[model samples]
Target chain A: MGSDRSARYPDGGDTGTDRAPRDGGGRADTGVGRRGFLRAGVLAAAGLAFGRPLLGESAADVVRMVGARGPDDEMTDAVREVLKAKFGDRRIQTGHVQLDIPTDAPDGRAVPTILDIDLPITPNSYVATYHLLVDHNPDIYLAAYHLTAGSGEGPIETRIKMRRTGYVRAIAEMNTGELWSAAVKVFVGLNGCG
Target chain B: MPSMHHDSSRDAPTLTFTMPAGAPSSVGEAKILLPLSVARDAVIDVRALLVHPMDTGFFRDAEGNPIPAYFVNAVTVTYGGEQVARFEWTSGISRDPFVRFPLRASREAQVQVVWKDNKGGVYQQAVDVKFA
Candidate 1:
């Protein structure tokens, strides 16, 4: 299941990227999809207004255009920037959170990682949000898993793309407003930013 | 439409899947594996798989035209009508992704898994959470 194959999904539903669903059924009631659509539209408009090259020749070029931080700078700045923006002055203690990933990944397209939290998940106290950040990837905020008390205390296991050799950090936000974190370093031969 | 698969291993959990009513397209197939029987308050591992391309805009086709990003944006898990977990993803997720997590068996209810793509396509499946 963790194989590094380049197989793509069939083009059966690939024709609707540009068109917003006219009738989204339940989606129309929640309005969540509308928010996502609006955010994407705003970002696209900003890119156009600035007159900057929105498209890139390659994944690396795309990353460079998004943000141009030196490799050395990313070694520390990547995690720090996210921490400053998310946690701010909140203390992010380590150790309660743990991450399991391969030390050397031949293909950066899919590197499986498991997240385990040594905390309780009850109605009063639980991990509300789990953030996975890639220190060197084009998009540092790789994914976020929102959990509720009903989720039952369980380890989150999934695969992610890594652009290069860097730290993949997992930060958990508790319902009590506490933050916990853990990180793992991985080396990737072929970046999967694309 | 929904497809079902049975496990060969006796220890493997039984999986039940059902598509959401009036879903737009058969965007993809999704499967959720949970044990058929579990002790009260027992913590068990639940594995889920969704068939997706997870395309990044950087990729091009044979004609050298950009594929345009089309990926699963989020996956939500609900237990007996209450949300248990929601995973927000980007193009960074792998193709045909499999996500495994630990789930505590507290009662007999329905376990539903939904996958929402970037283009507002939603695919869902559910299983009965039976306790031993």
Candidate 2:
């Protein structure tokens, strides 16, 4: 669809608005669980496979149910599953890090996003692989990127499709007993994602 | 019969970010019909796209709780160990922010992209471009 974002893309960047601030973003050291999980909401491939959206949970909380674990722990569960499947239930913290995002998105379909890490990722002392996840997307595993000593300390710019407004998390497992995470919940307008 | 006026502006918009086949994920020849060349000192437009949902944290969950808004705040593109461009994301930006721009020339250069959210976590990707 034609959008102001499209016009801004050619060169203008994005529109300017003193968006109202919501909950804290990049709250890295906030507790471990119950809150402060990067898009901690998980999704159940089962629910998606069966078309059971959110399993009667709140739209925001629905994203928390990523892999059929419980209604409130979707995103966390899915991320844990991703880590477990890839890293064998490695040590991950619900509060190791936080995901950075805009507070007021004009639309949802193509909302820009960035995943950040508060810890160091080096050749011998850092996170080797990371997963960028969206809990409520039609597909939970939006894209996973592996990192090495090469990637600098910053963010990998990427975008994902949101079936609806939900949580997004970037789970990073270090070589040691350290797991870092970051999350940000996003809201989208109706018909935001096609 | 009475005429029914449809609110043209009320219609929901559509979004698509599918790139054509054979499109290179990094610098060099890519699909999408844009003429770009990758080389040392070869200024060429690099087509970079990431598929994202870009949740604003403003939408409601199944229970209707508010989904907080979130998006990338900054983006940096570096060529051959040198920073070429930096982008700042805005709320007005679309979900998937794709741009075709000139990559400053560099031999065996890597197009390194780093983006950060409002929090401190960062994500990075490096695309190597070796000019023939």
Candidate 3:
């Protein structure tokens, strides 16, 4: 199983290629050498600067999803179901956001996704929460991110598993209760629901 | 049967793990990758990687047995002793979850990421942000 997982996500190793741009061209070694050294140094410096318990008890904040009325808008039935269940009666406008993803993803195990919201993150008005929804998947609610004004221009970059190929929707709820959404349809090959 | 794998190249810094004495061993180790250099008030990307199966309970093992659902349900990010962001995730997330979000680096502070699984297991890692 481990080998299978590795084969599926080849770049899952500590290649550090993802950090190339952040390093400011200090070193661009793709292999495990100079780049890896700097990565280790950064981690080491962070550890020494602030050492504390990694794990401890915390108040469990469990999420409960209840069904509700779907949004009155123009969208696919699958997406409407999700919107209805997640954000009922909230007018979900279709603008001010975009889903940055590949149109055709050959692999479904890890499809790179970026949700970019062109909104100001200020104390008075900011995107408070962003919900990632897939039209067709084992579960539609991929994730919901809560952000405050301190998050700056909230842009989320992550990898998601698509059971098949369908629309990936991102809905951002502002602090003023304004709901804005954007979606993109993707073609995915190779089932990644495993 | 969660396992921990640290890259051979990394120095393997102090990654504090808090597994209870009699509890089932959960997969340990997570890391926060910050830019080596950052200017004042620059909105930089804070990348985090967590090790977890994120099993969706929809897949079967090699022996045809159903794999139970196990995944990180919540991820909280705190900076300078204040909660900046929190994520509510489901099994739809891929294995070995990796996430990057933009954060304004106003001053030097400690950034901590906490990953909570559905089985009441909490895993976390922290890194200090220093301005260049």
Give the DockQ-based CAPRI class for model 3: acceptable
Pairs clashing within candidate 1 = none
Candidate 3, residue A193: the lDDT equals 71
lDDT of 3 by residue, A30-112 (tens): 44477676776676556544322111112221111011111111234455566777777667766687679897988777899
DockQ of 3: 0.29
Candidate whose TM-score is highest: 3
**TM-score of the B chain in each candidate versus the native B chain:** 0.76, 0.63, 0.78
Quote the lDDT for B128 in model 2.
Answer: 70
The C-alpha TM-scores of every prediction are 0.67, 0.41, 0.68
Model 1 DockQ (Cα-based): 0.26
lDDT of 3 by residue, B8-83 (tens): 2133222212334774344756879998898988888999998788888876766667788999999999999889
| Model 2 spans with C-alpha error above 4 angstroms | A1-88, A175-177, A191-193, B1-132
lDDT of 1 by residue, B1-132 (tens): 001222222232222122357743334888889876678778777889887777767656666677788899888888878878888998888777788876677888888899999888888888887876
Candidate by candidate, in order, the iRMS in Å equals 13.6, 12.2, 11.5
- Which candidate order results from sorting by TM-score in descending order? 3, 1, 2
Evaluated with lDDT, which candidate comes out highest?
Answer: 3
| Native-to-model Cα distance after best TM-score fit, residue A191 in candidate 2, in Å | 4.1
